[model samples]
Target: MRFTRLAGLSGIGFVLLLLGGNLALVSAGFPTPSDAVGFDEVARLHADASDALRLTSALLPTAWLLATIFAAGVFAALWRHDRIRGDGWALVGLAGILMQCVAFAGVGAARLAVATTATHDPGTASHDLGAVAGLWGLHNALFGFNQIFLATALLGLSVSGRRAGLVGRWHAAVGLLGAALLFLAATTSPYGADGVNPLALFGLVGWLLWLVWIVGYSVVLIRGVEEEVPSALATP
Candidate 1:
């Protein structure tokens, strides 16, 4: 199959993974770190013995793996389209995505450790709870850094795609807007501090729109691949 089709399918799958993870967390009543005052509370909410909580913890790492695949597919599509033109942005975007994925995996691992501690050791739960909170803070900090790299990847793709005529100016513009908003959010996130920012919430809105754009972009690429098939098949 064409790289475009692969990218489209991967993008769809990535979105599904995110949605599924969020749903699982919500079903388990998992509290956001902001809501939980300390490690003990974090453990109480997220590291519970309930099956739903375990599912929620598992979904986070699984989602990161899916994101890595999605990023790889996007990188392949971008490189296929722009490499002949000597555009380096595709590689830049790929590097940024890889960084984001690795950092996210770290966060997932930390979260999983906290969950494991909470599940297996009731005797040490109180004593180790503070350490788990520190881990949670580290995870949040990692997430904030991940968003910065994610924004970089998005911006790189937007500029490169527009220059290569792979996508329209307006489409690229929307991507730029989304990336800018995310960058702002990343900068204001305070390196994973617990308190919230209104700008970060606004950035979340942009992120939502940005996700919609990705889905639409993937559909366009998939259709382009469909259009190419007949011509390739008809060639002698």
Candidate 2:
């Protein structure tokens, strides 16, 4: 019931999800939007994919859903102590995180569709494959939206945390830096998720750094201020 403990557990789950998802991706050879070339290639890949690949692909959305819950918990825990506009930042960040989760869920659904229906009737398979390809094409935008909002939320949290004396200025700085990187990486056409090739790399780096910040934030949340903070938020 403790907020900090919840956050810590959430953080741990997130890291585990990240590791597991990537491993699954590797095992499944699931083509990311950034890597796949066209519909035919995607169709072929899906047709050849094993059940493990399809099921593993479903993990992405589950992970993101956990992230959304974590974000809400974090915002609730921090809002109380945050007087210097931290509340607003936390709210915004929560929103961003939620939106990102939705986007990721969308991607996951597309992946699952292939995994679930890849072996159906040829006509169904063709339609599903095309859907997957279209989803992949839009992946950039969906993913970019997440990065942008996530960056905003992180920056807000960092600033608010620093102001509350819950975290150091340097900690906040890292978040800001990470957010900046994500913003650039999030640059994509509004109509689609398309963006510069190299930018995705930058975004990936930024996301990793932000995850590091979350680890620290989880620590802080677990070790909240002594008296005013609730036992649930303060205690591990």
Positional deviation of residue 61's Cα in model 1 after best superposition, in angstroms? 6.2
**Regions of model 1 farther than 4 Å from truth:** 33-36, 56-69, 80-84, 121-126, 191-198, 225-236
TM-score of model 1 vs. true structure: 0.80
* Model 1 clashing residue pairs (backbone): none
Give the alpha-carbon lDDT of every model.
Answer: 0.65, 0.65
Q: Residue 201 lDDT in model 2?
A: 66
lDDT of 2: 0.65
RMSD (CA, Å), candidate 2 to true, equals 4.6
User: Relative to the unseen true structure, what is the C-alpha lDDT of residue 62 in candidate 1, on a scale of 0 to 100?
Assistant: 59
Highest TM-score against the true fold, candidate: 1
